[model samples]
Target chain A: MSAPPTPPDPTSDAAMTRRSFLRGTAAFGGLTALAASLAPLRELSDFSSTEQFLQKYYKEMTPSDMAKVIARIEREVQHQYGVRPHVRDLKPMDGVEFVYCLNLTRCIGCRKCVHACVAENNQSRNPEIQYIRVLKMPHGSMDVEKGDHNYKDAQVPDKGFFYMPVQCQQCKNPPCVKVCPVNATWQEKDGITVIDYDWCIGCRYCEAACPYFARRFNFTKPEIPKDRLNPEMAYLGNRPRKMGVMEKCHFCIQRTRAGKYPACLEVCPVGARKFGNILDPESEVSHILREKRVFIQLKEEMGTSPRFYYYFDK
Target chain B: MDPRPTRPGNSKSSRTNLWLGGLTVGFLGLAGLFLAGTRSPRPARADIPPVDKKFLETTPWRQTYADLVKAKEDLSDYDCYGCHEKNKPPPIRFDDKGKIIIPKEHANIVMGHGSHDRNDLCYNCHNEQNLETLQVRDGRQVKFDNIPLLCGSCHGPTLRDWDAGAHGRTSGFWDRKLGEAQRLSCANCHNPHSPRIPPREPAPGPHTLHETTPPAQPGH
Candidate 1:
């Protein structure tokens, strides 16, 4: 430099006043405190924002994009659970419209199906998320309100009660899919309603809209023991769901898409549960609906057109 | 020939030996042909029980209940023939009041079958001579596996429902191409004696934030 520039005079008309100087200092200090206070929020934003913003809607994603996302999820699950999860994006089988039938007369009020669902779905163990709820109803009543779910009996089919187990109806006219603001949930070709865990904004609109009370929300980061985490996970079904997302029974999509029965159907000791493709006339569900006097749950007014049917021998 | 000085009986003996050998081989060939033509019936010795032809002919309805199919208690273990082999014991003995008295060995069993006390007798279902086999109303012996036919004779509607895959459980596969669908037999779910399904402890109920009780009214 040619020479040191002469300093400006403090008393000059253009110079800062003492009030202005103090105001500047205070403003700088306030901004510093805010940045420090919001440090955790910034960390959260960094962790989620990039991946979440990049995530495309489930139906909008291409095959390669879905593969990449599945691989990423596999890595994340492995990092968290210390177990390598087989996360797959299985499409629905052709000409398959699945239906479930529960025989109210045969149901012994045993909840083996409930436990089997939890285990197969890799639900949160600490918070205890279960998809199936068996209601102990009075012998003559079909009212769900009068039914007690918390009945602790020495044996089931209580002396004067009949057991009814309820789960996701997998409706053809699903209200939950309609109310999702983010389009996180939709009906698959096989008539299964599935939610994309990553895309859900945690608004719980679908949870509120569900008539059967089938949806579950992940309020906190779900904690599952390493040993208890089901490694065979489906991308849109039983994969390790993150915090602030919604989940429900997807009819064990991981297993069912591979031509296996749902966990609930497999575990029913009394042979009370039945599942099959409704499109086929010879399928068990179709046979039950055709021959037996089968009725859908809550079919009076709310026409969800549920695939689940409850029937007894006439 | 003259030089050899053969004995006069040599030619006759050779012919006799040849005939004997031919007869032995022909007998063995005939026995082999008989065995090949007909399957040898299982030996019906006194020590070995006779094969139940009815049992061999009957095919059991597919059992879908895995638990019942895998049940530990097997009928063979009971050995019904153990006591009934030599003694043709009467199926039931009546007291002076005409009440059926179970024999000492069967005292532990409770008989609550449908109208069994009045209209039915043990011989109606149980074969009189062969206690191991069940009998249809027409007196045809039915195997244990074909118990549905015996039950179907009375429960026509239920059998129809069972056949149509409405009343009982069908497990395994929806698509027959993928796997076999098994329909459960009556004995799989119901006790043949009591025929009524009993209750058992349920699995843990749902753990929702709110219980399943009806929501409280605003004023209440």
Candidate 2:
């Protein structure tokens, strides 16, 4: 639509001569080529695959590849939660492995550990969001691998009963990490497996894949009172999650990162918990494990390379 | 969201996956819990050693009998033979009605019966013949003061719960008035013959809680 201006009529001899001389050369192909290139406008519709088109978490994608994912995540959170939080790309701290152990022998049937985990994790108010279940075991039983969590209140023994608590095993070869199609759940360098909540599609593949019965599905929206919420938090582990994703005990990652023991470990009154790095043989847990027979959870089979160890003193 | 998350190419069958994923996993979880709650099955019941039935028979050797008889002697219908005796005194067995009773000197001795672990060997602390000068703590040489030390032997578990401010002989020391503090004998809180945890009080409804049925009035 933009046309080149025509030469104005010359009012004087000098202008006429200039215009006439200029028109003499323009009368050739020189002017038309400029108009054709500018007028050849075309629209291209991109039909790349959804994976290629969606730039997701930088953790899931390289920095150059994550733009679309980050933007979409921001938009989704804004639309659904009315607030957009920064979706962080966290790498596990180096030379550290977040390990957990439960002293099943000493655990009482008091559900203090479960409650402590809830307060520490800032888990959604839904009871299903619970990361721990203290299985009320009968007295003189050591096989926690065989322990199940079907206990109702009546199962709490009025006399002669012990308890065993179970949670995420946090395996080295986490089956959940293997099954995530988008690699949303990953094992950090520190041996903690975390989910990129932003990248999670709520596929629940993680729940199906985990062999330990650890992960849980958040089928409903999470609602929590503001005051009850643990203000101190982390993105990969304990941050309150939305509906339609799988969550489980994160080993109290927020607390562990700061060199504090898990809340569940601290609240256990019976001294039923021991936590340390397996790599460091000098660590108290490692020493206890070396001195006493420290059996990995579910030691019989299904070797997931779990770091959690438990044993009873005779 | 998993309208069709399962793919035909995924090597595991969805049926197997569904079973392994849920029902199998849930069943295993249930099986594990059951295992934890049950007694070990390997130990054969027949292997248990036979109990010496006579070890639990009654006698007159127990020193506490003096306290029961002397302190509450006027109280009629006390079942000394039932709670403290099982067989008869050493020389006696069946009475006129074919019932067991204490015989003369052996009438005061407790051979054993029912939770003897908590009640056995009463004379070890008590003076079997002497009922007057009771042995007690503070070297009181009275029968009562010795109870704190006597009961502390096996009852240390509960007594420890008390010392650590957990269990036993709870006092009203808090109110300092109505909740005043006092130490009572283990007998005051728990009847040695039959001890039971008090049932939680039910919601106040129409339940007379009378002794009409009266637990069949256990016999000596």
Question: On a 0 to 100 scale, what is the lDDT of residue A150 in model 1?
Answer: 76
After superposition, the stretches of candidate 1 with alpha carbons farther than 4 Å from their true spots are A1-53, B1-78, B86-89, B94-100, B115-120, B209-220
Per-model root-mean-square deviation over C-alphas: 34.9, 23.8
Off by over 4 Å in 2: A1-55, A60-91, A139-160, B1-220
> How much TM-score does chain B earn in each model?
0.56, 0.33
**Model 1 chain B, poorest ten-residue lDDT window?**
B49-58
Residue A119 of candidate 1: its Cα lDDT? 74
Expressed as tens digits, the lDDT of each residue in A1-314 for candidate 1 is 59886666655645674334544555554555445445545424422545656888888899988888888888778877889999889899999989988888788877777877877798876566778888778777777877777776777676777888888999989999999998889999999999988889999999999989899998756667787678998988898876789999999999778777887886676677888888888867788888777865655469898988898864
DockQ of 1: 0.12
lDDT per residue for candidate 1 within B24-111, as digits (tens), equals 4554455455544445453332231222223112133223233444665444534687666645756577789776677787866566
lDDT of 2 by residue, A1-314 (tens): 99887555455454554324444434332333333333322110111235523544645467545545545544544454455545433455555676665555445455556666766676665433566666545555655544435443432333555666667888877788888998778887778887766567778888887776788776555555555556555666666676566778777776565555566665543445666555655444555565555555654377677767666543
Worst 10 residues of 2 chain A by lDDT: A40-49
lDDT, candidate 2, residue A167?
74
Give the per-residue lDDT digits (tens) of candidate 2, residues B1-220.
2223455766555444444345434544554554443434532222212222222122212234335665665523233444344433323355585444545654544343235434333344443344333333333444453454555654655554334322232221211222333333455434343333222211111111121222221121
**What is each candidate's fraction of native interface contacts (fnat)?**
0.34, 0.00
